[model samples]
Target: MKLYFINEYLGDIHNTGVEGMWVYAEITPSKNIDKFNDFFAALVDEENDFEEANFSEEWVDDNNWFVIDDENRKKGICIPAVYPDGVIAWRWR
Candidate 1:
């Protein structure tokens, strides 16, 4: 399974239920792929530590990360910008 490092925000915008805020970190690969099992284990441990340190939410059931601001708004999802990271960009489709 491929791993992704993401930042998420949870908040409200207008008169609607808001998923709030989200932010993503630079997603990097587990370097030591030779020891895939151990590498994944270490990654999991590191991910847990990171969650505890920052978002307070574990990287589990990574579905439904965000919601729209108004009930009438069409359902859409946010995705990473096409350009390089740290570009302060987004593609909401």
Candidate 2:
């Protein structure tokens, strides 16, 4: 139930599709154990949010979160480098 907005470019050269994304967030308990397990079910539930949304299993395998590219990349907001909430944060803002 937490949200994050990483203002810094954290990905490295080895990372492709996301490495150039400008910014991204890492959400844990991501997709959840239930949905994740359902994904591997022999007969996957066709109605699953992930399946319905057409999110690749690989995307789920890797962490999933919000990503954005905005002119205000590092503007107007700031949070601790290591936030106490340990849930949501706006790094390097």
Candidate 3:
């Protein structure tokens, strides 16, 4: 399993009124970022609920959305400043 610092909440497809929070997911990393984006684009958790985030055709950018970190250190609330230049991948748990 790989670790990812993700901002899945603020994308165009979903939201939870908490855009500043990030999820440190220990997931099976995806092969590529496109696959990662597609997987999440279709992800809709009923338990979590996204029927109010106004579903869209797109989400975050492949080059600017997330980063894969095994050590689990990426500040989503304050990014590019605290953590600059890191490998981004589609992490799955």
Candidate 4:
């Protein structure tokens, strides 16, 4: 599954920085949303000791997660706090 980081500015798990910047996922033939969601949920769980306020570039890298660069199409996990909604896939012609 393709993970997306919706909000990068505001530090709110329930609220995204942008009005419509909700966590989104694009499931491909090789990707599974259920697995990704399960993994993400575990990380965000309070018992996991994950602190949204402590999220950082180094932290992401250490945790085997990454951000999306528009210029380059790379895949990696993103912050879970901003992902309050379901995955979205758009098709345009």
Judging by lDDT against the true structure, name the best candidate.
Answer: 4
Give a tens-digit lDDT track for model 1, residues 1-93.
122224333222322222335333332323432223332243345345423233223332234233333344433334322112212222234
Best by TM-score: 4
Question: How much does each candidate deviate from the true structure in C-alpha RMSD?
Answer: 14.4, 13.2, 13.5, 10.6
**Residue-wise lDDT of candidate 3 within 61-88, one digit each (tens)?**
2233444333654422222111111222
Per-model TM values vs. the true structure: 0.21, 0.17, 0.20, 0.30
lDDT at 7 for candidate 2?
Answer: 26
Candidate 3: lDDT of 89? 24
Each prediction's total of clashing residue pairs, residues at least 3 apart in sequence or on different chains, is: 13, 0, 4, 2
Clashing pairs in 4: 1-31, 13-81
Q: Indicate the residue-level lDDT of 29 in model 3.
A: 34
Which parts of model 2 are misplaced by more than 4 Å? 1-18, 21-25, 30-33, 38-93
The regions of model 4 sitting more than 4 angstroms off are 1-31, 47-63, 73-84, 87-93
- Tens digit of per-residue lDDT, candidate 2, span 1-93: 232223233221111122242322432433333333333342233454324345454433323333333432323223212212222233222
Instruction: Report how far residue 44 has shifted in candidate 1, in Å.
Output: 21
Query: What TM-score quantifies how close candidate 4 is to the native fold?
Result: 0.30
Please give, for residues 1-93, the per-residue lDDT of candidate 4 as tens digits.
233333222111122133343444432322333434444554556667765455444434423434444454544543343232442322211
Superposition-based RMSD of candidate 3 using all C-alpha atoms, in angstroms: 13.5
lDDT for model 4 comes to 0.37
- Predict model 3's lDDT versus the native: 0.31
